[model samples]
Target: MDLRVSLQALMGRSLTRAAVAASVAAGLALTGACGGGGAGGDDSLTVGLLLPGGGASRFGQFDRPLIERKLKELCPHCPAAFAATPDPAVQRQQLESMITRGVDVLIIAAVDPELLRPSVEAAHRAGIPVVAYDRLAQGPIAGYVTFDGAKVGRLQGEGLLKAMGAKARGGQIVMMNGATTDPNADWFKRGALSVLKGKVKIGKSYDTVGWRPENAFVNMKGAVAALGAGNIDGVLAANDSLAGAAVSALNATEVRPLPPITGQDADLAAVRRIVRGDQYMTVYKPYKPAADAAVEMAIALGRGKSVESIATGTVDNATTKDIPAVLLPSVSVTVGNIKDTLVKDGMYTIAQICPPQLRSACDKAGLT
Candidate 1:
C-alpha cells in the first residue's frame, strides 16, 4: 500500500511481463473494484480520448489501443470517441468538440499544457471532468496518470554516466531537452540535472521545439558545430526521437565511434539504434498501467465518485493544485538488459528488434 516502497521495488529490478501485470492488478485492487460505478451503470457512459499524436507514434501504437481495451473491459457499453493530433490548437478544438458533444468524461494527453488551459477550463465549466493522461494539462482536471518523470530522468542520467565510463569524469555532454511547452520536459530536465550537474560539464543545452526530431536535429547540429563533435562525450536526449536525431547529426559531422547518448521512450527504432550501437540506452515506461489508470479515473469521475481510491498520489499544475494522480514507475533499458526488461515484458520481440542487418549484432548482444 506504500506507493513509494512499491515504486522503489519496481525500479530496483528488471520487470517481466508477469511482474508488471501483477503490479497493475494490485493497484486496481486498491480501488475496490476495477469496474465500479460510472455514467449510469457504465451502460450509458460516453468517454472521449484525446492524444498528441497517432500513426506509428507511441500514442497510436500503444497508449490508444491499451486505453481502448481497458475501457471495453471496464465499461462494455461505454461508447468512446477518439482523436489525435500534434497541434495544440487542433487538440484544443477537439477538446471543445468533445465538450460540445456532452461526453460524460474526457481523457486528454495535451500537446501543449498551457495552450490547452482555456479549453480544459471550458470542459470544467461544462460539468465534464477531464482526466489528464501522460502529459499534465493545466486547469481543473479531475485526475492524472503518468510515469514518474523524475525517475525517468535519473535513469537516463545514470545510464549515460555509466556508458561514458572514464570519459564521464571530465567529459563534456550536450543536453538535448524536450520542448519548453511541456511541463514534463522541465520535470525531466530538473531530474537529470540533479544527477548530472556536479559530475559533468554541460557544453551546450537546448530546449527542442515541439519535441520534434527535425528540431532536435537542428539543435544537435548546432551543438556539434559549436562544441566540436570530437569534444562532445555524451548526449542526454529527452526521448528516442531526439536521440535518433542527435545520432544523425553526429553521423553527418563524421563523428566516428559515436558517443554515448541517453534517451526515453523505448521506441522500436530507438531499440534498433541501441542494438546497432548508435544509442546508449532508453527508459521504458510501461503504457498499459497508465492507460488503465486513466480509464478508471474517467469512469469514477463520470459517476460522480472520487478518484482517491484509484490515485496513488497528488500533483499540481500551473492552474490546479492537489490533483489526484497515479505516477507509475519506469525501467532503464540498455543492450545489456533489453531481453530482461522490454522483451520479457512483451514490449517487443527478438525478431522485431533483430533484422537481417542486425542479426550479427543481435548475436553479439546475446539477444538471439
Candidate 2:
C-alpha cells in the first residue's frame, strides 16, 4: 500500500485493525531500509524507558508493557531498562542515571515537561536520542508518539454537551483540569473550551495539582460547596482520575442525581463508572499503536538512522521544530458502545467490564 494511503487508513479504525496496520508499516520500514544511514540493522541497542506513573496507573497497566513487548519484537537482542515515578525531581534523576549508564536511546513520558528540558538537552549532548512518548517533553527530541490532545478534549467536550441535553443550555459546570506542569493538560483544556465557551457557564475551574485525584477531590469538594451541587449541571474533567474524584466529591456532598461528567483515558474503573451511570464518557486512545510507534522511532534513532520512514507526521515542541511525530487517533467510549469499542477492541473483556456487582446495569446496557 502507498505510505500516504496507509497513514490515512490508520485514522478512525478500530484498535485491533489500526495496530495491525501499524505493525505492517513498521515491517515495511524495516525491510525497505527507507532511511538507513546509521548503524543499520543493529538490534543490540540499549533502550531506557521512563514513565510518569506506575502501579495501576495507565502507564504501568498498559503503556509500559506494550512498549516493552513491541521493543522486544522489533529488537530481540536489545536490553531495555525501565523506571516509573510521578515526581519530577525523581524522574530527572532517573533520566540522568540512564544517561550515565549509557543507554543507546531513551523513551520518556515526562511528569513535568518544562522541568525535564535540561535533562533532555543533556541526553542530546551525550549523543543519546530521546523519543518523547505520550507526553511531549521539551528540548531536542528525535520523535514523538501520542493521541491528538485537541481531538481528545473535543470529544470530551462534545460528549459532555450531549449528556447534558437540556441542561447544556445556560447550565453551569465545573472544569476539573489537569496539572499545569503537563502541556497536554493545557492543550486538552483549550480544545474543550473551544467547544464549551459561550455555550455553557463555567462556574468553577481548577487546575488540579500534580494531576492527583486527591487534589481533584479537594477542589471538587470546594466547587460543590461554592456552586451548590444542585446548581452544577455538568463537569468537564480532564481524565478518568479527575472524573472519579469529581464523582466521589458529588456523592459525598449528597448530590442525589450525579451530573454529566467527562473523562479521558478509558480506564477500567472509568468504564465501569460509565456503565453504572456515574461518568458520562471516556476517550479511549489505543495504546498499541502509540507503543509500536515509540518503539519503532526509538530503535531507528538508537541505530543512528532517520525516523522519516516511521514517523507519519511532525510536531513542534518548545525547543525543537519539525520533530518527527506520530499522533494517533482516539475513540469516545460510553455505556452505549462499550461492547463495540472497548470489548471488541480487546482492551477489556465483557466479563471484566461487567462484573457481578454490575450485572444488572450491564444487562440493561446490553453488555450480555
RMSD of 1: 8.9
288 Cα displacement, candidate 2 (Å) = 0.4
Instruction: Please give the CA lDDT of all the candidate structures.
Output: 0.83, 0.84
lDDT by residue (tens digit), candidate 2, 1-368 = 00111233234211012323332222211211122222334855778888888779999899988888887788877767777788887787778776766778889999998899999999999898999998889989998887888888899999999999998889999999999999889889988999999999999999998999999999999998998879999999999999999999999999979999999999999999999999999999999988988998998899878988777777788778788778788899988999999999899998999889999999999999
Residues 47-85 of candidate 1 have per-residue lDDT tens digits of 878888878999989998898888889877777777788
Cα RMSD to native, each candidate? 8.9, 8.9
TM-score of each: 0.90, 0.90
List the lowest-lDDT window of 10 residues for candidate 1: 8-17
C-alpha lDDT of residue 255 in model 2: 94
Model 1 regions lying over 4 Å from their true place: 1-41
Model 2, position 339, has a per-residue lDDT of 96
